[model samples]
Target: MKICLVGSSGGHLTHLHLLEPFWGNKERFWVTFDKEDAKNILANERKYNCYFPTNRNVKNLIKNTYLAFKILKSEKPDIIISSGAAVAVPFFFVGKLLKIKTVYIEVFDRIDKPTLTGKLVYAVTDLFIVQWEEMRKVYPKAINLGGIF
Candidate 1:
């Protein structure tokens, strides 16, 4: 299956990278920030840089939404996956409209509270995974997959 891996730089990126066991054999491309760490980690991988400072950045959100549409259309991945901060929002929403399956793994650190991106994508995510059982209380439909680390 073709996979579209999307996340921010740093820990979010590492979280997704840890899932290489699953994505490693699949045809995949990434959507993430064009940062030094991402550059180093994904040096040999196919990647598209997304607009960042995405926490509450409205302009970048709009830009990313457009980028999502463009990339999703062109790549047409079978699934979209993320361990996210904020960049996953536009891709999940647009992926929903395009009928692409989505999986959102709530960050390992947020034991009981939900990340803003998780809350936003929960309704549309096909599978919601949480590292901590406590997070299931916050995301009632989430499955506890234990920590990826």
Candidate 2:
């Protein structure tokens, strides 16, 4: 199945990378920020760079939404998965509208609190995965997948 992996740079990207074993052999491409770590790690992989300064930036959110819709339409991914920062929001939203199955992994660091992106995507994601049991309290329906790393 074709998969679209989406996430931001730094810790979010690192968390998603830990799932390489699952998607590496599959037909998958990535949507992430243009950062040194992402560049080095995904050097040989197929990827698309999303806008930076995400989160609260209204201008980039609109731009990223357009980019996400364009990518999702062309890629025609069967599933879209993400471990987010902010960039994943548009992808997940657009993917949902396209009837693409979405899986969201809550960031590993936020054990006690919910992330803004996490809260937003929770409603639309088909499967919500959390690393810590404590997170389940916040995302009651979330399945504790232990830890990606």
TM-score of each: 0.99, 0.97
lDDT of 2 by residue, 66-118 (tens): 99999999999999999897898999999989999999999888897999999
**Across residues 1-149, which tens digit of lDDT does each residue of candidate 1 receive?**
99999999999999999999999999999999999999999999999999999999999999999999999999999999999979999999999999999999999889999989999999999999999999989999999989999
By summed lDDT, the worst window of 10 consecutive residues in model 1 runs over 108-117
TM-score of 2: 0.97
Give lDDT per model, in order: 0.96, 0.92
As a TM-score, model 1 comes out at 0.99
Top candidate (lDDT): 1
Candidate 2: C-alpha RMSD after superposition? 0.8
Model 1: pairs clashing at backbone N, Cα or C within 3 Å:
none
